[model samples]
Target: MAEQNKHLYYIDELSDYKISDGYPDVRGWDVKDIDNRVIGKVDNLLVNKEAERVVYLDVEVDKSIIDAKYDPYGRPVQTEVREFVNKDGENHIIIPIGLVDLNEDSNYVYTDIIDHRTFSETKRYRKGGNINRAYENQVLGSYQRRRTGSADSRDLDVFKDEIRLREIIREEIRRYHHDIDKDVTYGTLETHDASRPRVDDDVLIEDEIELSQRRSNDEVYDDDNFYKRREFDDKRFKKRTPGL
Candidate 1:
């Protein structure tokens, strides 16, 4: 989730910096793809206070398929979602700060680094030891591998890749169980809309910043939604040598 730098806080929470002269708070901006197709709306930003930089734009992505001519950004170009056969569920993707494109409009953020599949498959963001350094390395490293192909990356087979992904998520669940505070945690196996905001021109918006949003239910964990812990037999999930 934006590579947990030691310094992370809402803009107003920290007094170390001020909004630079020309930039706008991009919290509720529309995130679009290269073709100017609507992908999702910006929810909040993860700021790396140490760097005085924005590290990520949390976006809620639309995954339902529609009938259109190569609308790669997942917008229903021609027909509404109901007009076409169903596709898939939605996701809240963390668009890396480096990947965003800022234009003069100041009301939108753009990115062409990926498509719907990548955004949907990537794990949702949560704070804590839930995100491991190695996993983050593998995740961020995947962008490059996704570009050039993956002969040197984990070097794992397709089956192993699935296993690795599951393990990564498993570790996160375990860590959430241990943490005193978890901004977001696994609530149910059901398709859940992670707490994200929506705003448009019609509504008068507040310029407030939210570090994280919790799912509505008070109970963050449900045994029915979780699986029995199993051993991965690999040392990487246990040891610190890295390279899973």
Candidate 2:
């Protein structure tokens, strides 16, 4: 007697997946064997737009038991298959939509139907596909590793040189301002007081006093000449002398 296979419905058949509503929640799914042996948990859903339903699932199986041959959506690609086998040492498998049954409350799929040959064939196809293209699709290609060592040192040196030159220029500017401040203070003391004698007037008085002292110290004078006596005894001499 042939064994009776269990019937499964597509995602669109569910009442919540009608035209007015959004996608059905398939978070509750468990990968199992024909005897209902639990394999893995359903990690994601793969929706098919043409069919208006979910056609595949992303099952997280044990890495020791199976290799990852396809993307999370079950699309087969080469680089993933190569890495999965060489690094993980397991084969990738596929579970068809028809074989799975959804459990709404548990948010899981339970199924006893699985196509082993089809799953193996899909893995072979992915292995034969272009690895470079597969890697490009799964990874962000634009990001690069940070440069280090010699290249980083060169950049730091350039920055330090710029900072040193800026500091030198700032010091020269500060010294120029300081010299201007000292000259302004000296000029203010010499010119701002009207009661105090002017610098030029004080200099002239000092010169006249020295000349009178020099003439008084000289003894070569005509004692008999009244004009000579008047010249020596004039009011100008009294003004020039310190006691007068």
Candidate 3:
């Protein structure tokens, strides 16, 4: 009865189940698992077009892995084992959907009871070390496309338009300055020549000489007055002198 019950349980668990139709269509190669949670959004897939089969998926693991040791190429090194292991002593393993009994409706898988240690060992064996190389190739191809001559032409046209606009602005500024100069005026004639009375050269010279003589006379008078005051005071003081 026990063996029969075990058989029945195995049959029940192994039956085909459909993943939800709402789930995005993922190729067998694109599926990945972390404990019970599955990560199905793959960045790239390797397809066999002739056979209509997906051979492998090329995905970028979450950047959190970089918290571990990184390689010279900036890719996280897989050698750091702690990030990959779960609390149950089972390493968080990634398995191809092809290796599992997938339930399409539930988007899950079922497997026979497996020891945690054995699962970890199997995961280490199946993990692909050269996946980063494939990613590098894809990046190189994208960069090359951007560097093509056709792409450069579009950039050149944009720069040409910028230069033409600048030239138009410079021409407008020059025209503005030209108009300003046309409206302004300048003259070299003296102010009196335009509206004030003009004196003869001899009369102007005589007036200047007369003014200079008057200033000299005023200075001489001031000096004489000071000398006279000093002499008068001295004589007055002599009269007041004591007999001794």
Candidate 4:
């Protein structure tokens, strides 16, 4: 990213995405490996404004697991035990979304290819520091290496121009926002102009139009958002169906 665009924010921080994708809100879910070993709990997600997709998942590693060495690379040789501690979110790992498996069953995300050792070995996100494209590539490449289920193989290499990547992202985001602005400016007017207002027919109007527009707005858009669905995990909200 450019010097001006080095700032990284959580997905919830972006206004347009919240209005569009309805806040993924997958934070607080557990992150695990394919075998169901607890890796971390999701702290947050990183959004690439240019790409309009989640790029990285900010995960807080479990201290007990990080403290013990585990082979994330799937090596037959057991990893030698080492001591590492989670101090001030230092143990957090920013794994790319490409490697993630969003498991709705247990509501835990999984990365089938990596483990504690990989996260501990790789260069991680430092608070208050800019993540240059080169650093980001290393992180992505690190995960990619293990994705093939191989501890030893050579199939992942792409020479990327960080500066060029920055320019491309900026250009993409600019065009995306331009189209959005154009639509916002004319969408209502276009709809109104298409249909003529008929005075003879009485308008039986309700606030359903505004409510329907909010279908993808926020937590309210959720089918049983304010109320709980039958499969709800908590008791704070009412059931979607009326109680007996």
lDDT tens digits by residue: candidate 3, 54-151:
33333333323323322222122466645323233221233222223334455433322222222222222112232222232232222222222333
List the lowest-lDDT window of 10 residues for candidate 1: 207-216
My TM-score estimates for the predictions, one after another, are 0.40, 0.29, 0.22, 0.48
User: Which parts of model 3 have CA positions greater than 4 angstroms off?
Assistant: 1-24, 27-34, 37-40, 70-97, 100-103, 106-244
* lDDT at position 33, candidate 2: 42
lDDT winner between candidates 2 and 4: 4
* Total colliding residue pairs, candidate 3: 5
| lDDT values, one for every candidate | 0.42, 0.36, 0.31, 0.50
lDDT of 3: 0.31
- Model 4: per-residue Cα lDDT over 1-244, one tens digit each: 4545353467666676652332245689888875668877888777655445556678777776556644333222434532222334455667665556565546777765666556655554443244444445455545544434532222222222333544565555445544644433322444333244421112212223233333324333223231121111222111223353
Pairs in steric clash, model 4: none
Best by TM-score: 4
Give the C-alpha lDDT of model 2: 0.36
lDDT of 4: 0.50
Q: What lDDT score is found at residue 106 in candidate 1?
A: 52
**Per-residue alpha-carbon lDDT of model 2 for 55-142, expressed as tens digits?**
4444555442344333332233555464323233223233434445554455555553332222322332122122122222121111
Which scores higher on TM-score, 1 or 2?
1
